[model samples]
Target chain A: MFDFFIHVASIACLYGVLALSLNLQAGFTGLVNFGLIALFGCGTYGAALASGMGWHPLLGLPAGIAMAALLGLFYARLGRKLSSDYWGIATLSIAEIIRISITNEQALTGGAQGISGLPLLFAGLKPYDGMARLALYVVVLALVWLFCQRLVKSAFGLSMKLMREEPQLARSLGYDLDRIRRVVMLVSSAIAAFAGFLYAHYLTFVGPDQLVSPETFLIWSMVIIGGVANNRGVIAGAFLMQFAMAYVPFIKDALELPTDFVAAARLIIVGGGLLAFLLWRPKGLFPEKVGGSNGR
Target chain B: MIEAKDIRAGYGDGADILTGISLSADRREIVTILGPNGCGKSTLLKTIAGYVRPRAGSITFGGTDVTAVPIHEKVRHHKVGYVPQTDNVFGTLTVAENILLGARQLAKTEKEKRFAALMDQYPALAGKKTRKASALSGGERQILSLARALIAGPEILLLDEPSAGLSPLMMHEVFDAIGAIRDSEGMCILMVEQNAFEALGIADRAYVLSLGQVAMTAKASDLLEDPAMRKLYLGGEVHAE
Candidate 1:
């Protein structure tokens, strides 16, 4: 039971990092970055390509972040002419393009077979034992959480929120919209890339399938259902969603339900929850910043 | 000092809203543009602020031709401070943050100093420093907008219909604030206002615009006391001088 709990906790931490990164762009900036999966995929591919060539896994982490940032710059440049639903479409198209490229780039990404035998994060530490792995993962989670908390409270974060709420007002106040959007996109993508590195190393495997649209949809749902603008809410939503996915087998087996029915039931629960949240609380559980209330 | 010579500007290739509109404001002077609705008063202010480019002629400030300077560049150089009519303050940002953002181009130390000075000048804003701009009343928002623009320490302040949609009491307060700013800072102030009588009373000089053209220009007191001017433009009624 302890081992199971630790494994669940570790996965939750990974997803929490992913959701937090997405929140930076979507929640604060009101940028519908559907191409988030592209950044995540870039990180995974960057790490896999670097480590597959026998480089240090730690070195691969920064490489992943750099690759993701570059992609974010590209997105920022393209996203300038688009807004509202058009922006969403543009980003979604970009994500699809990234996925297709990964699938076609057999030499670089190993195509469908994916990459394996990737180096562990800390070679000196034993990760086969569940508790040790869980501890290390928690450490990573804590670091990311602290960094995100500080980032959302900084001046840049305030600028992003202002831009999100009213771009015209932001412009009048001397905010260069293009510059702010690009920087925010780069930073958010880099954070997401870092989370990707963690996932790659955690699984000891990386694949193109992991960077597809379904994963993007899952992350968006997690952010929306958890709370759009709340950092802590994203973490909670990610954990809840991951826990549901992970524990479905136990629920199914204990209830003597068929595998297909269990899969359908899980989807129904997640879908219903997401719909209810959106219909009832469009701003999510924690609304954006309120007057005089420092978001804690 | 600022000058707009025969400036023609509009939303697009349509009838020029500000047709051959020439005006000037000297340092330590209040120049008010008074006109009826649909006149080009606000457009004139926007053109001067670099928010709208004049289709013809030049806008010279401090003896430099800044007719083509972008809005952000103009703001960075402190050449112009614009207080838009509505929704000028960023609703999501705190009043303090909004003021800080206005002075973003200044040095960090200078920005801090200006922020402190503004807080001292506008005591009503002090208690609301940490409050979101959206939570402020309309009058407070207007004051915050003016404060934000002033924090940039602009050489020329462009105010667009500051008295629009305000209670009479609020209008008095806003005009009082403007008077204090002009008296203390000695900055060049250009304002577009629908409240013709009140604007002329506060202005050092007043320009009357009709159909995007300057109809008359004179001292504010003379315009306010002119029976013919009052009968023709001031709501078709002549008050005893």
Candidate 2:
């Protein structure tokens, strides 16, 4: 029971990083990125390739971040001409294209069977490796939370919110809208990629199935339920929803429900959660403080 | 001072909305642009403001050729202030944030000083410093927008319908405030307006457009007294029904 809870905590912390990344782009920058999983995939594939190449395990970090940043720049370029809704569709399509490409690249990515048996990140810790991994994720989540909080409170953050709410006004005020989008996409993608690196290492596997549209929507549910623009709200959201998801199997077992119920629960959690919050709490669990930057 | 010569502009391969429009406004005066809907009043203002580049003319601000400069460059380098007709204030920003959005380049002391002075100038916004702009009334939003432009201490102010969608009393008050800016600050204010009588009342000069062409240009007083002009553009079914 103790080990199971630790495993769940580690996964939850991993998701907290992803939720923070998505909220920073979609909530504050009005990016509406629907291909978050693809950015995460960049990290996973980076690590998997590094492991397969017999490179140093730590080398994967920068490799993964670089690929994600390049994809981020591509996404930002798409945004310069496309409106938010169209840009969302474009991102979703790009993610699908990437997944398909990886699936067909049998020699490079081991086809759909995937690459596994990745070395653990903290082999040096030995007997306490699991706990060490969880601790590292927790520390990472804290750092990301602090970083996001600091970002949103700064003048640049104000410019981001301005771009989100009133983009034309932001441009009129001398902000390079395209440049802001690029920076936000780059940072958010790098963060999402970091989560992917952790996920790949901890699970010892990389597969296209993990980079699906639904996984991105799951993160959206977390952001919607936690808070849209609030950094702490997203982290809290990630943990709560991740635990809810992690416990679904237990619910199935306790209720003696069919195995398919586990799959159905994902749809319910994402779609129903989004609908409920958008209807009742449009701003999410913790709406940004009423007085704008002054409240912070 | 701002001047445009024979400006022709449109958007995204569309028909030229502004054709051969020439106008100028100098310091200590308010120049009003008036026309019927689809006659390109807003387009003309936008062209001069650099939101739309003129295809066949030149724009000079304080003796610099700024025709190709974008709106942001014109604003940051040339000290231009613009207020759109509607949805002008940043709803999510606090009143103070909205006012200070463009003054990021100002010195800290100067920014704060101007902010305090603006608050005193617009007492309706003074009490709502920390309040989000979304909560303000329409008239207050208009005033807040004006205050935002004024805080920059602009050399040229471009206003698109300062009294748009306001009660007659509020309209009069907005025009009075604009007129005060010209009289006191000697700022060259060029505005596009639909409320012909009120706009002309405060403006020193007026340019009337018809079908993207300059239909007339005259002193505001002369245009106001021209009965045929009021009937054709401001009164009767042409404007009312």
Candidate 3:
């Protein structure tokens, strides 16, 4: 039970990072990034490639983030001419292209079989392996949470919200839209890639299947359910989602439901929950807080 | 001081809305641009504000050609302030934040100093400094917008239809605030308005635009007495204030 609980907590922390990252773009900056999975895949493949070459996971982390950043910049440049609606389609297509590339590139990515047995995060701390690993994840989560809080409260955060709410006004106020969009893409993608690096190391595996659209949808749901712009709400949303994702299968088993019905039921529940929330609480659990002069 | 000489401009691939229009405003003076609907009054102001680049001619402010300067660059480098006819205030932001948004480049001490002075000038806004700008009345929103533009210490202020969508009484109050700004700041003020009589009442000079062309340009007082001006633009009757 202790090991299982730790495992669940670790996974929750990992998803929490992803939720926070997506929230920074979709919630705070009002950017619709449908290609989060591509960035996540970049990080996973980066870590996998590095570890497969016998490099430490710590050394592999930056490699993953850099790859995600480069991809994000490319997307930003491409998205310049497209409207928001088209941008969404463009990002989704990009994610699909990245997944297809990974699937076909057998020589470089080990093909569909994937690379496995990557180095553990705390292989040095052998006796208390699970606890130490969980501790590391928790520490990273805390640092990210604190950093997000500080960011959203600062002048930079104000500029981001302004850009989201009033792009023309933000531009008139001297905020270069191109530069702001690029920076946001870079920052959020790097953060998501960081989470992916940890996930790949923890699972000791990397495969194209892990970069599916459903995984990205799960993160978006967490952000939407928690509250778009509120980081604390995002964390709470992640836990709620982690709980549902974990126990829905258990409930299905207890009911003796057919294996095919499991995926269908989970989708129905999540979709229905999102619809209900949109109708009743469009802003999510915590609405974006607009600060007054007191903040200055 | 600012000058626009024969600027011809329009939206992309659209016919020229501001066709060979020229105007100027000097320090501590108010220049009013008046026209009928679709006569390009707002477009002329937009051209001057850097929203529309002129296809010909040039705009000079502070003795340097600023025709090619972008809106944000004009604001940051040339201290050019602009308030759109509508959506002037940031609805989600508080009144104080709206005013302080332009003061981002100022030192903390200077920002506080300007905030105090602006509050003193517009007492009504000072009372609702902590409230969201959307909660303010239409007249109050106009005042808040003015305070915001003024707080930036702009050398040139461009206003588009400052009295649009306001009651006569509120309009009077808004014009009073504009007069106060001119008296206090001594900045070059250029305004585009449909409120002909009231605008001419405060303007030092007035230009009447007809079909994107300047039909009349003279001292405001001189145009107010001109019978043709009253007949063509001012509705042939001045409402009793």
Best by TM-score: 2
Our tally of clashes for model 2 stands at: 0
* Model no. 1, DockQ: 0.34
| Candidate achieving higher lDDT, 1 or 2 | 2
Compute each candidate's TM-score over C-alphas: 0.83, 0.95, 0.91
lDDT of 2: 0.89
Which stretches of model 3 miss by more than 4 angstroms? A52-54, A78-83, A110-114, A123-128, A293-296, B12-16, B53-57, B210-216, B237-241
Q: What's candidate 3's DockQ score? A: 0.50
Give the per-residue lDDT of model 1 (tens digit) for B54-130: 89989988888989876666777655788888877777668897777787678989989999999999999999998
Query: Which residue pairs overlap in candidate 1's backbone?
Result: none
| Least well predicted 10-residue stretch by lDDT in candidate 1 chain A | A287-296
lDDT string for model 3 (B89-156, tens) is 77888899898998888899999999999998889999999899999999999898888878889989
Which 10-residue window in model 2 chain B sums to the lowest lDDT? B232-241
- At residue B225, candidate 3 shows an lDDT of 85
Return the candidate ranking by lDDT, descending: 2, 3, 1
- Chain A TM-scores of each predicted structure, in the order given, are 0.92, 0.97, 0.94
Interface C-alpha root-mean-square deviation, candidates in order: 2.9, 1.9, 1.8
Off by over 4 Å in 1: A1-4, A51-59, A112-117, A120-130, A262-266, A282-296, B5-23, B33-44, B52-58, B90-135, B205-241
Candidate 2: tens digits of C-alpha lDDT, residues A177-202: 88889999999999999999999999
- Give DockQ per model, in order: 0.34, 0.59, 0.50
